[model samples]
Target: MEFGVFATMAEALDAANKAQKDLVNNYSLEQRDQMISNVRKEFEKINDELSNFEFEETKFGRVEDKIDKNLGGILNTPGTEVIKTRAFATDKGLTIEYSAPYGVVGAVTPSTNPSLTVIGNGISNLAAGNSVVFNAHPFAEKSSSIAVKTFNKAVVDAGGPNNLVTMSANPSLATLQEILESPYVKLLVGTGGPAMVKTLMASGKKVIAAGAGNPPTIVDETADVERAANELYLSTGYDNTLMCTTEKEIFVSNQVLDRFTNAFVESGARLLSEEEANKVRDLIFVELESGEKVVNKDYIGRDASKILSDAGVDVEGDPRVAIFITDKDDLFVQKEQLLPIIPIVPTPNFESAMEWAIEAENNNNHSASIWSKDVYRVTEFGRRINTSIYVQNGGTSAAFGVDGTGKDSPTIATPTGEGITDASTFTRRRLFAMANGGNYIL
Candidate 1:
């Protein structure tokens, strides 16, 4: 159980290689489906255990939402979907084309989605006929370990290789490096910060690096202010906005600013008092190494009441949400503050709002949202910012399937590059060609 001491990268690779060979050697398509089904059942059994671990360890989102993500991973993270294959008889003989697994996969899980990421990536890699060696986030070690155990049990029960999915019992910087440098690791799939993604990309290996994001949600004059406020509230509060697909900033047209703010306040969000706002501005903002003030990490994902209390302000009511009304110039509006706090910036018009929104979004280049009744306005805004996901008439969480959004799994912070970490997100494709009747050459 103590993966830190016993589970070296070499051991992980050897186990994974054996699993891959077993998959190619023993299991046919029928066996693969049976294994997939067994894994899905095991996921259901461990759902509550993983959900509890995630809530206790990360404290990032709701327990219910985490459970939903676990189930979604089991149900919809993609399976073996084969494209067209061909066989032909040539003058020389017969030729056939087929797809095969890429051998051992090196996957790194993120803390924000500990259980869901493990299950999703595990299922995807299995479907691709590859074995996996996961480097889970240190913060969610218990959850990650349980996930690995559950997967391994499922595989073994289904007549597949044991340890087909392996992970370090205790993930650390040293363990991560060993996994990256291992020769048996054929490909890398990462979901973490920019530093980690950059490290994986530089390892001289094939990597599917999922990076970071600063998503923005836009509300224009033509928007349904009430619906937009409701959707935004749901998105920003879903699992405390842990998802990279969640809206990090809101850009509202001056025409609808007051209406949207009022609606937001009516929906259990509290506007910080002037004195309290000043305290938050001091406590939440800090100077970076470049001497530029930025939102402090201490407040990120902390409850609004706790943030205010730490800033020496006390509130009588139960207020979980923080509303900051500031100009676009404020550091609060211009950055990806990953807390329950929302900054509402007003622009003169829709055009100006879109421009300001894009600027506020900055380099994160992830996802954005819009709440508009006008189809043209939605289309225009989608065209303008050009984020990975441009949600209309809904919160940013809609991109990830929470609160009646489209049916999708939880997304990783690496939105700009890989978007979401789904089944295909963890795979690579190769083309196979066969000559029919003639020996042809270029």
Candidate 2:
């Protein structure tokens, strides 16, 4: 099996399959845990350098946010610890549950989160006793390669087999399709956009996919305006809004619109006039001949200065957040603007705000948030939104368990209804039966 570089998808598949046979398929629980720990250490050792490389290679995201994302994948992403077994007993038989692996896994990662996604998915896949073959994004090929090589080395250094994680040198649609068609690749794990997820699902293999989102946030009259503003600014401003869970739009109840606005402005945020907002919008989103507006990828994860400079505005120093006003029907509110730009909309009441926020979420069911102290209103909002992840009076980072508060997951499978993915998401349930056993719960 190859060690560091793979020239083609076939090589990646072959190496990963060999690793699965030599290490993953036969690893004991203790051995798997040791390897997982080693991977985490290796990640931390190179996280700072790797994060900088990720930013340099992809030209997206803030180095600070990438560092945090790398650590989140290590500390928060669930491993074998989340894997559980269930048992039941009847008069005639006893049944025990086991989390069975999917053999070799084919993972397709995005440029936005190259190393982060690889490590997060690698931890879970290894914990589930499956070797991984990666199809890294072309723009992030170098960073992804470094991460994969370090990860594989970590496993081997911990007395694990070679090719525990393998990837090709350059990634393309052809290679991704090739890996998906490979017989050794038993399952697919995708962390990317809609088109990539669609392709993986259509491959006739079982898939755990995490896709796009235009997350929405609401500020009600009962909320603490300052806290809300700070949290919102911190999230969207982080890494120039590269996170899928970053707040794309905000809906504030008209009752506290003035208060929210003042607080939002005090939090190092600069609001553009209606005319300026139009200019910024035009600069951020380009209109096609087909009448559809799309985001300019060049500015997708760029900083505030770059985006604002393009909008014909000059700033003294680096500002944290750049916000503008937009109506519900505005293009900024309709589509996802994956930059430090956030759209604020005014709603008449709590109900209207909730409706507007939910509508802005676009049914991706990925993530949403609200700022409110009212217990009843919070409960109502949570129930109505029913999103995969709902942050209450907190930033979008809460969805990733950033401070050890919420659930940690790499694959937030919204369509499959497995909200926050973990080691359990990668495995199937198997039953072990004993003929003469006892029924306890019954």
Model 2 over residues 277-340: C-alpha lDDT tens digits? Answer: 8888889888889988899888988988888888897665777778877788887787887788
Best by lDDT: 2
Q: What is the lDDT of candidate 1?
A: 0.73
RMSD to truth, every model: 3.6, 1.9
For residues 1-442, what per-residue lDDT tens digits would candidate 1 score against the true structure? 3221135656766777777788878887667778888999988987887797878887766677678767877776666653224565657545655555778888888888878877777777777788888887888888888888888888778887787788766688887888788888888888767788788888899877666667777788877789888767766866666677778778888887889989988887878766777888889888889998876766666667777778887765756567767777777777667677777888788777777888877756677877778788778878877777667777765665645555455444343356665545555555444545444332
TM, every model: 0.89, 0.96
Score candidate 2 by TM-score against the native.
Answer: 0.96
Model 2 residue 276 lDDT? 77
Model 2 residue 188 lDDT score: 90
Q: Against the unseen true structure, what C-alpha lDDT does each candidate score?
A: 0.73, 0.83
Backbone collision tally, model 2? 0
- Deviation in angstroms for 396 in model 2? 2.3
Clashes of 1: 3
